[model samples]
Target: MRLTIPLLAAALGLCAAPAFAADGKQLYLDNCAACHQPTGKGIDGAFPALAASKVVQGDPKEPIIRVLKGRGGMPAFSTELTDLEIAKVLTYARVTWGNKGKPVQPTQVTALRVGAKGPTVKPALAH
Candidate 1:
């Protein structure tokens, strides 16, 4: 019975992205876990860890650009993920595993998209 659900989803092409668009962990699982691991502890010497990394918790643009443009061995997700998805995934990483970073909004991701065309993203208000 449980198996049938997965099989049905697979057969109907209902097992990806859209179904989990707002879920950062799922998005990470689908797009990043292979290299970054489920716990955000990436394989040493291969992929960097997100658990307590300064980069992940630092300027959001650095990671945003990396996700969009890819760096070193990482693959670019700009073509596959929407701005909101990227923001969710990044926000998940930033807030998870004890790291202290600001939430990344979809507008931030949209702002950094290469050749992206749309309304300009306004700066966040000071708290």
Candidate 2:
């Protein structure tokens, strides 16, 4: 049987709360581990390694924007995950795998969400 967050949490005697209340590690395992792997080494060229990744370890906004924008094969989590969940997952990614970075907060995610813009279309030039 595949071990999921709730199952792992129950095994460890952790509470089975909603994703909003779940910890960063759990969120990461549930949502990102498939691609990024538990070791954060990722799947070579398919999925970039999160360990020591410049985007993951650099400014918080970088990861946040990527998560929200859906770069390459990475799906956009802006609609799927709550601000809190995104913050926790980003924080978890930043701090784990020997990476050193500041923790992201929901407020920061919210600010970015508010300021984020959809794709823009350029006006057609006269033919």
The best candidate in terms of TM-score: 2
Task: Please give, for residues 4-122, the per-residue lDDT of candidate 2 as tens digits.
Answer: 99888576532322232347888899989999999999998899999999889888898988887678999877777777778878888887888886677677887887777654312
TM-score of each: 0.72, 0.74
Clashes of each: 0, 0
TM-score of 1: 0.72
Q: Which residue runs of candidate 2 sit more than 4 Å off their true CA positions?
A: 1-22, 118-127
* Local accuracy of candidate 1 as per-residue lDDT tens digits, 15-90: 3333333467778989999999989899999999999999999999899988887888997777777787888789
Candidate 2, run of 10 with poorest lDDT: 118-127
Error of 2 at 26 (Å): 0.8
